[model samples]
Target: MGFRDRWVDWGNGSGFYNLRVDDVSIQVFRNGFALIILPRYENIESSDLLSHVFRDLYKAISYLYNIGIVVDLDSIKQVNQEYAFNHGYLDDVLRGRPKKARVELDRDARGLFNKLDQKAKAWIDRSYGDLEIETNDLEYARRLLLMPEIIYNLDKKLAPILEELSNQIRLHLEVEERTLSTLEKLSRYIEELRDLQRRPSLFKRILNWFRRWFG
Candidate 1:
């Protein structure tokens, strides 16, 4: 019902802000990017689930960004500075590796390490284990809420099928939430993501125009 954020240490000289709801996680990165994490479920059809989640996330971001959660130029500078310094200081990741297995950082990515100020770097890197470092720094949670990939952990299956009886009208789906007790409860438009492949319906296109003026 509400949204909140916390700092997450990404290691190797990077980290980001994290906000979550049940199984869905929203992340804002230091580099001005966002991601929404959703678990692949066995109950709700995936295409239907993606569409519903996309809309909900879009609305939530619009509402939240309009209210206050913002990342300005100054914040971007600070986060980058911190990440650059930390990455440079965390020499272990770049050193002591077999020549064949060394990390292959791109030119621009590797340059971040050269711009570091050792004195400003966090020696302890509290993000490794300390839980209390800026635990209340929600404002520093940074920006971003959507983009890129949807990583599905196949090993993290929702639930095993206990029964598969034929001719059954009802199916027990172990998906998004407990409230979705049956398959019928999923959204009526089950092909939201797939629908993008063709073209949007006339009603939907017109409906969007009306929303812009009315709401």
Candidate 2:
């Protein structure tokens, strides 16, 4: 039977689900939402096996969702860029807005993985029979097998949510500034009208109209 160890914490409001199938380990992070991290799989040499692993991962995720788990797929993007490529691009991707910035970053992330896979395969092809091959190239091949840490559809699906939130924040701030300016202008106008009443001069009214029209 497959082994599973899952826990949900109340106080810290963060939880994780871990499932083990043979040598693979799948871990899920749950807080405001859910993000599942696919376990490391060995043998990246076969592209067919790698594709199968991705299919199996989606199947597992579907099962979890069918059972009522709200999972965030974007979490995978972080792992793919940060752990897999060992590149410094994760920070820019995660910290940036999900609409345009995140989309752009994830494209870069995918490119990185593709490049690594190509490099690993090329290395394998070149060193297939060579006895002088170094350990570094072999390690890269192993990494290719270790399921890319990033999830699919993360940026595309969530970009709208991110864009909405950002727009709301910006709209609220802008409205507030406009309201403040209007109120200040109204207050000053009331004071001028009060002065006009006290002075009772036609010239003051004409001056006020001129100021309103020009200023």
Candidate 3:
């Protein structure tokens, strides 16, 4: 089944509030506060999807920030129970599980900034000419890296990356079975080294004794 979605009311002339990234809905208010809600899905893996959602959210935030809007970090910083899936595979994950998932508040904002900086560097390649046209500012990228909403939104974007990383690992393991077998053979050879018989040559034995003593 697919994801079940919802959105808060967008009043008339309220300075554009609705932002949807895939199945997640980010409702922005005129006052800069925003709420991110996720759709409920059944029996679905969330690890990857969540990553992509958050990453794209960061992109969206970059878009918003460039327009000179102050991002409310406090409003969208934390992940609440409201964002979790309400039904389908997601519901099953919480069926016998706890009502809420543990969210970590401690984070490295500096690292996030570094990432934003990298993206901005790439963005310049595609926007260098446009950047010179006066509507260009990199401060938004800086704000996005520093804002809590960006981080919160980032969690959604990262889900897909995580899934892709997982799939890559799985593929590597599957395709490297022959390499694993070769390593196993090497391990066996090492294990047999201790059982190797001593040579009977007096010269070789004397050399071995010398090596053991000082070489």
What C-alpha lDDT do the candidate models reach, one value each? 0.41, 0.49, 0.49
Tens digits of per-residue lDDT for model 3 on 1-215?
01113334546644435666666676666564766665644334534655655666676566557655556654444433211222333444445554433322233222221322121121111122211111012343245335788888898999999999999999999879979999999999877653443434665676699899999
TM-score of candidate 2 versus the correct structure, residues matched by position: 0.29
lDDT of 2 by residue, 1-215 (tens): 12233554546665566654444455655434444445534334444645865776677667666656545675434224121223234435445433211111121223222432222221111122221212223344354445344233566678899999999999999999999999999999999877777776765777788999997
Top candidate (TM-score): 2
Query: Which stretches of model 1 miss by more than 4 angstroms?
Result: 1-5, 59-215
Off by over 4 Å in 3: 1-16, 21-23, 39-46, 72-75, 82-215
Task: Name the better of 2 and 3 by TM-score.
Answer: 2
Candidate 2: Cα lDDT at 36: 42
Give the range of the ten consecutive residues with the poorest summed lDDT in model 3: 126-135
